[model samples]
Target: EFFYENIQGGDFSQTKSFPGLSEHSSNFTLYYETDVWGARLSTVYRSDYITDGDGVSSDADEIGFHATTNVDFSAFYQVNENLKVTLEGINLTNVAEEQYNDSADRIYNVTTSGRTFYLGASYKF
Candidate 1:
């Protein structure tokens, strides 16, 4: 499966930041799934984008934000009619990007649990 989206907004302001906004942005995602050897595997990829800020001071407007492609993988296995095993990996690439704070005049990297893995088992009665 595949998906795409676009977002548009007018000029806006924040509590402590410049009066500007990302006029246009977009996102895309792809997903795939299949069954093999009684086990199921799934994968997903996503892309993000953001237009540069506008209507702000020249100094603050210089800052920008964007994201690299991100991927995730997962698998599930049936141990028995009443039991199952599962595994998942998130942010497999440790994707991250820098964000600029106009008011603070600072830049910092933002991320969400970069590159994580999980495993578990479940039983049904």
Candidate 2:
């Protein structure tokens, strides 16, 4: 499946919306499941947006600001009718962004947790 969002900037009372504010974003997912096994994968893509109170331009008009993409994966297994196990991985590609830091006056790479994994089990009463 796919999802999308669009955000517009405007003036509300005396407060103006931020420049970047993630004007557009999309998400996609693919999943499959069976009696014994299941798997799911998802990806997120976002358009370049402005930073609030950072005085930075949108990704289209400036350097340092840019769009981003990330991916995640998950799987599960059913050992029996009453029990199951699941495994998940987040940010599998370690996607990150580079932005201009006005204070530092240089381009810096912003990173997330990189890659992480989780294992869990469930039982039915």
Candidate 3:
């Protein structure tokens, strides 16, 4: 169990409709790795913003889960004892909607990136 809170920037207005923004975020991750394959499970949650001085309020909340799996195909491979290649993957679960905010009179949310791949090569000479 874990928890945290933070304050976000905001603007205030009398006729243009403005509100203060703040957010709280929390998450948990369980990971496991092995010689051939590995997996990780994670969950994230967030709270709506609390208006600073404005009376209005917004409805923006966030909650999501992600799972990632990796494979070490080169665990027992050799390329003539000279050069070897390795491949990797990131954000395999393709989680989305990682951010959210609700305050004053507006609500917004966004997701950055998901499901990426990486490749690497090494030589011993």
Candidate 4:
């Protein structure tokens, strides 16, 4: 549900950290359910860190993630006792997955997958 740590250690040559290791990351979730209705919502978050690197150097095009967040949701409803319907969605905020040169302002690359959704039904015997 939550996490916090300072991943500050890397190759003996430097006192920094490895690639793709973000510090201070966390997750939170909420849920509700009833005899005929159920729903859930969740959010995941990660703090900024030295995301990555092409070649080990101070200005050698370092990569880092700018503290991004993602939200998702799902819900279900029971029809009678033998049928049910469901719905779900992802990336509700559409927060593009991004890459920067150390800081967030210095945008190096940007990409967005757009929001996604799904619907379905099931029957039980």
The TM-score of candidate 4 is 0.75
- Give the lDDT of residue 53 in candidate 1: 37
The lDDT of each candidate is: 0.50, 0.67, 0.40, 0.73
116 in model 3: Cα distance from truth in Å? Answer: 1.2
Query: Tens digit of lDDT per residue, candidate 2, span 3-120?
Result: 1123123231223334566667899999999999999999999876535332333332222356788899999999999999999999898877767543333565565667999999
Model 4 stretches astray by more than 4 angstroms: 1-14, 54-61, 102-105
Off by over 4 Å in 1: 1-58, 100-112
Q: After superposition, how far is residue 91 of candidate 3 from its true place, in Å?
A: 0.6
What lDDT tens digits, residue by residue, belong to model 3 across residues 11-104? 4333211223324556766665655344455555444433333322333322222222322222223445676655555555565543223332
* Structural similarity to truth (TM-score) of each candidate: 0.52, 0.66, 0.38, 0.75
lDDT of 1 by residue, 1-125 (tens): 11111212334433222223333434444444444213333333323222333424544533445435556677777767778788887777777765664434366457566788899888998
- Maximum-lDDT candidate: 4
Rank candidates, lDDT, best first. 4, 2, 1, 3
Candidate 3: regions farther than 4 A off? 1-76, 103-107
Model 2 misses residue 78 by how many Å?
0.8
